[model samples]
Target: MARKAAIIGGGVIGGGWAARFLLNGWDVAVFDPDPEAPRKVGEVIANARQALPALSDVPMPAEGKLSFVSTITEAVEGSEYIQESVSERLDLKHRVFAQIQQVAPGVLIGSSTSGFKPSELQEKAPEPGMIFVAHPFNPVYLLPLAEVVPSPKNPPEAIERAKEILREIGMFPLHVRKEIDAHIADRFLEAVWREALWLVKDGIATTEEIDEAIRMGFGLRWGQMGLFETYRVAGGEAGMKHFMAQFGPCLTWPWTKLMDVPEFNDELVDLIAGQSDAQSGHHSIRELERIRDSNLIGFLRALKERNWGAGKVLREHDERKAAAFFGATDSAPKAAPLEMAHMQVLPGWIDYNGHMTESRYYFANSETIDAFLRLIGAGMDYVAAGHSYYSAETHIRHLGEAKLGDRLTGTIQIISADEKRFRSFVRIMKGEDCVATIEQLCLHVDMAAGKSSPASAEVWAKLKAVADAHANLPLPEGAGRAVGQRK
Candidate 1:
């Protein structure tokens, strides 16, 4: 059954939380008095629908239902979890909690409060243990961190449940050691934000210049190797201990107004706002969001390649989902093309011709074949053991074009196979239409000896079964065509 989550507000943060839940296959009920809430939340979900799938190696779960409810009771009733993101007013949050408890008293309630601690939020609350903090970053659907803060009143079982739920939606739940104002990540961000303000206020830098410094320098390092680790690398021959000792004196330096505050006034606001407007005013908010999402996708994918930092979370999520989606059973393949891969044409997949680049079409087929190989017990472990399949020849035929945001499927039909080699036909489809086809021949090899070799009995048993199943099917049209063959 699809789980249900209640979102008490539908502003940006709330909308983001709604998208995260909905995309992760949780039905969501959002309660926000703003008349424009649906349209606003819809836009965030649209961005999510475009961006999140590109990060997944396996097919994403079917999106769950979303509804804008009239009241907190309607939103919370029957919900397995509730994420309160109402305005940052304690009284307002307390009232929302009161109403929520009247219906579903024990459901897990996570607050998307960036500043407030769990203790303050739990005050005067019945079942305060369930009402802890789940602070997520902006673009919650993409960035995975959710700082989970639990009060002493919150039991260990409930806190563990909260962390597990966050993981199911592909979030990294950093359990706060103790409930404190602003949790962990935001505390660092607040410091940076304050310093940025002081920089602009004192004419040290404009908003654009400060942003440039971060995105162009340490921000890149921090993307994968966060603060201490990045500094550890800067330690060069020595490690973090040596580096810390060397730079410890800089902590007392007056280089930053870390302890001081710039007067929160119109002048500072205007200076920052006016400079920000000049910096990125050309793009609309939606444009900026799309830009940010695309850039993040690239960076995160790089991290995923290294299986480091946030990428490890993404990879682990993919492995779990793939195993569940493609059940390890069914070793005997059916007499048809096995649908092995699901992918979307992300913004990064486009070319100047405004269609999915030719390379991605080929990539789709490779992904499909790779999945099929995994099915036959000849995956990474086989490769690690110095025995693997190597593509010997490939022929790609493009029938139609795929553009950005198009959902694509890749399926493989095993044409023939023996102990050492196999011939396969793969289709790259957009909806019901075959946008392209790939014909490839592969040979099993003993990598250590650098020679083609017969597949092991166990692997061959699985591979031959699938190949024999497809043997009776007619030859795919144009399967053996030459490079310049006619239609």
Candidate 2:
């Protein structure tokens, strides 16, 4: 059954909540009094459509229905979850919760409040035990960290349910142990924000300079290793104890003015805004967002190879996706050749001619092989078991041009299979037209030994089954053709 969620506000955070739910196959009913709510949410969804899929190769659930309702009552009537993202005002939140409780009190309700603690928020709720704070970072669809804070009044089951739901949508839910304003991540963020403001106020560093300092040095380290872990690495042979002993004294030095906040007067605001403009005025907001998303995808993909931090999260999600694909009963049609890969040309893969680049054809072939590997019960778990298939050689023949935005499909036919060697041919097409073809030879090996080896009994049986199924098909036209000039 398709679950439904109600979003009480449709600003940035609310819109993000909508995208997260909708993309995960939850019907979303959004209620916001603002006249431009639909347009705002639509824009956020557009950005999400471009960014989220780039994070993983998984085929996400088909997007659920999105409806903009005029009344909060209409939105919450049949909702399984209700997320409140209105302005950060206690009065307004109290009123909204009162209305929600009047209609749907038992639904799992969460408040996207960065500043308010769950205890404070619950005090105003009609059903305090059911609501908690579910704060998330900006561009919520891309970033997976969600802080789930439950107050003393809230039930433990609510916290567990929230964690389960967040994980289902690929979020890392950090359960704040106690009620505290700003939560965990934001506390660190606020400290940095305070110091940056002081730096600007004292004429020590411009906005761009401060940003460069973070991005060029500690920022990259923090992204993968985090603060204490990075410090532990810096400790060399000793570890965290040594690091704290060496640098703990520096914490008391007159280096930062975190105890006091700079007044946000007009002059200071103008100065900061002007410096920001001088730094990034050339690019539009949308252009800047695209740049940020692209960089995040690239960096996360690199980290994924090492299976570190956020990369580990991405890898685990991919494994889950592969598991679901292999376990599905209603698979591809039992035809002569199974459709192995179905994807659109991503914007980043285009060449000068606005078509998919030549190298991407081989990459697509590799992906096709991966899809087949998952189907044959040789997926991440198989590789983790120290056995995997490695490509020995590939021959690709381009038949036609594949333009950007073209939907491509790869159909596979197993040419032959043995104890250690498996060969397959894949035909890549754009809808009805054949665009390219690839012939690949792969060897099954004990990855730990790093040498060719016979496949395990189970894998061999699966491969033999596929080979038998494909044996009836006639040889393809270009199966053994050479690329050299013919006499």
Best by TM-score: 1
Q: Residue by residue across 234-350, what tens digits does model 2's lDDT show?
A: 988999899899999999999888899999899889989999999999999778877888898889888888888888878887777656553542234253777777666765667
Model 2 regions more than 4 Å off: 329-335, 339-357, 370-410, 415-423, 428-465, 474-487
* Model 2 per-residue lDDT at 98: 86
Pairs that collide, model 2: none
User: What are the per-residue Cα lDDT tens digits for candidate 1 across 365-470?
Assistant: 8888888899999999999989999999999999999986677888888888999999999999999999999999999999999999999999999999998889
Task: For each candidate in the order shown, give its overall lDDT on alpha carbons.
Answer: 0.90, 0.86
State model 2's lDDT: 0.86
Model 1, residue pairs in steric clash: none
